[model samples]
Target: MQPWETRLEEFIAQQYGLSFDTLTKAIGKGPRAASKLAQRLKKTGRAEVARVDCGSPGPWRNSANFDDPGEVPHGPLWIFSERPIAWGYLEFDPGEWRPKASTTAHLTAVTELRLALTGLDTDPRVWTSERLLRRRLKSETGRVEVHIHDAWVRDFTDADKVWAVEVELSRKFGEGRLARALSAALDAADRSELAGVLYFVRGAGLRRAVEVAATRLAHQRDVDHLPNLEIHDLDITLAQKGMRS
Candidate 1:
């Protein structure tokens, strides 16, 4: 396979599937070109459209729980082959993978960030899915049952630092869960297991909440006034692909 084609497959297999726009962005191809490539891969036994195989709103969509039938939770998904490519730091078994009906937004958002960061001219960031972080945290730190964040990142120029990126579309933490979750992830930061923890929130309320949580945690841990946590607007970057105030 060509280098770009290999990248396309890698992106698709990373999440077991990806939207056409994501594939296009990741492979640096136009939509039409990406369409052609998807077709070629389909014909070549590498991929198949989910709608065709599973039927619309079939098992894959998991839309039965929604009250509004017109609301399409996610774009048409393109399912790929079960063949594993052994993505660096990421662990995925395509054959046994089943994407939850609710996580489509989160999953796609992650790939968008991956594409945007990959396009950076300098110090490009490498995004690893939560799967890899989970395995690595357990194996390296012997910390099991920890709440893994959305994604982990490593900049090309900085090999020593591994950062955690959390995308919060809605309120993810409760009063108690907030402290516990941040505590677990921040513990990694304290031990130098994670260089930084970044929370990308959808709106002001969510952003403020995350910020407050970080502050409280810092006070509790007696964190050296130099905090390693930061909260940012998700849409502030190209990854969100929308307007922000």
Candidate 2:
């Protein structure tokens, strides 16, 4: 495999899927080049192509069922600028697992964040993926279950300290799942699991939900147990860093 081909696999390994445009931007190639690269990966059985939005975020990606399954179309993604896209048809890793179409942007968001911090470099102490964190936290928790954030980040200004990152795309309270999770997270922070926690929320509703959840959890536990919890609007946060939202 060529160096770029290896990089392509690395990207898929870290991010569940990404648009051809995203690949274009990351690899300094054009859409057509991205298309060819996708085909190459697909030929090697390492990737597959499909849209994320049947027109939802960019077009319905996989809302298609097997019976009349819509085409897993292939084409170049839209790239009007250097900014990476958060949604669109994608060339994705093939496996038993598939992320939901609606959350494809969520995966993109996380990918963009990683790119901003460390590009394609692998350094767990600097940026640990949630995939890896799952094992680490599971073993650390033992019987004391704790909420796992999306990823862990080394503070940009202070490399020695690490913080957990949560990308909140929607409200989890309505599903009856966030409160206990939030409380458990607070407990983990109290136990000094990491330096702190950061939440990047997709909307005002999510921002409010997180605020309320943190407040209630803080009260239930000690307010000091909040562990430097910080929340920011996802788009604005990314914009501040000149990254794609």
Candidate 3:
């Protein structure tokens, strides 16, 4: 493990009440590095290292719980950011196995995009899941409740153009379900003058599904009349290109 990563692991373990294994998993480190870092921390007597026993039965045990599917918790506990504008949680089956670290990383990517969008503009408009729903849906027929783990929106008032932006990360459903969400967003954009949609995916399979959705949206003749769609593969990092005005 890199020196900084090891140090970070130690710090998170001490500060955030996360176990060594949990810290390593949360930070997306390999087993070798994770073990090395944990050992170093133990040697320093800064924190204790213990193995996590996954004796649970569900598919989502170790990772954050976002897929309760019953009552979504409301607060800053789910949201993780330096300056958070959106809230999200890791999705997994209850009483099942824990989710992979990559799943949480995918969630972070969507959160990063939401933060980036907020930095791009400084509008007083608040971003929330409810607001996004109202701004993105028009007719009741096209309205389908999106499993929104996290979301944020900012209203831009340039030349009387109001744009509501939202980012979502989901893993339970397939491409068809995402298509339905896109349709709802499109309908909402038509009514409220939305700017675009930024959809982030964690796995390659989901990435392909999102790509297919993007292609369909791009080819749709009516899309030009609605909000634009931007698809982001969270597994990859963005290239630091020149700044845009």
TM-scores of all candidate predictions against the true structure:
0.72, 0.70, 0.38
Order the candidate numbers by TM-score, best to worst.
1, 2, 3
Candidate order (lDDT): 2, 1, 3
Which has the better TM-score: candidate 1, or candidate 2? 1
lDDT tens per residue, model 3, 23-108: 44445666456556555545655434332233433233322222245533222112111111111111111121222443443433
Pairs that clash in candidate 2 = 51-61, 52-61, 53-59, 53-60, 53-61, 54-59, 54-60, 54-61, 55-59, 55-60
lDDT of 3 at 117: 46
Question: Which whole-number lDDT from 0 to 100 does residue 116 have in model 3?
Answer: 39
Mark the 10 consecutive residues where model 2 has the least summed lDDT. Answer: 80-89
The list of candidate 3 runs beyond 4 A from truth reads 1-112, 119-123, 126-163, 166-175, 217-227, 235-245
Residue pairs in candidate 1 whose N, alpha carbon or C atoms collide under 3 angstroms = none
Q: Model 1, range 104-202, lDDT digits (tens) per residue?
A: 667767667656655322122466666555655575556655667777778457888878877778776555676677677666655647787877777
Best by TM-score: 1
Question: Candidate 2 lDDT, tens digit per residue, 21-137?
Answer: 567656766766777776666565556565433343333233222113655433323211111121221222222444455666667778776766667665667777765565466
Deviation from native of the Cα of residue 213 in model 1, angstroms: 1.4
